[model samples]
Target: MNLDPALRAILVCPQCRGDLTDDEAAGGESGLVCPACRLRYAVSDDGIPDMLVDDAQPLG
Candidate 1:
């Protein structure tokens, strides 16, 4: 699913409340990565972002 640029622009990390950037290789899946927190927020096939902090995976 293609994420809208505008929506991505407004998205922030739930943990650090920092900026999120597209990370296709995140945890071997598509996701948004928070540089500050080093976490990966999953983006579902339908284009829904899982912004929950607890569900985020650690970035390599």
Candidate 2:
């Protein structure tokens, strides 16, 4: 999870436009979590965030 802090600050859930948190310690594969929606947006190996709601998984 090498995401830049500046970029992370501006990211929000595509579903609800909610704040996201780094889920490196979260269950399942690491991702950025939107607690309000219980969705986890996957982060690629190169540190790119997949913000697509269609591909987001349920937060564990």
Using Cα atoms with residue i matched to residue i, what is each candidate's TM-score against the true structure?
A: 0.82, 0.83
For model 2, residues 1-60, the per-residue Cα lDDT tens digits are 877778888999998998888887545455899999998888976778999999988855
Best by TM-score: 2
Clash pairs, candidate 2, are none
Q: Please give the lDDT score for candidate 2.
A: 0.85
For model 1, residues 1-60, the per-residue Cα lDDT tens digits are 367778888888888788888888725567998998999888887778999989999876
Give the per-residue Cα lDDT of candidate 2 at 13: 94
- Candidate 2 — which residues are off by over 4 angstroms? 25-28
Candidate 1 Cα outliers beyond 4 Å, as residue runs: 26-28
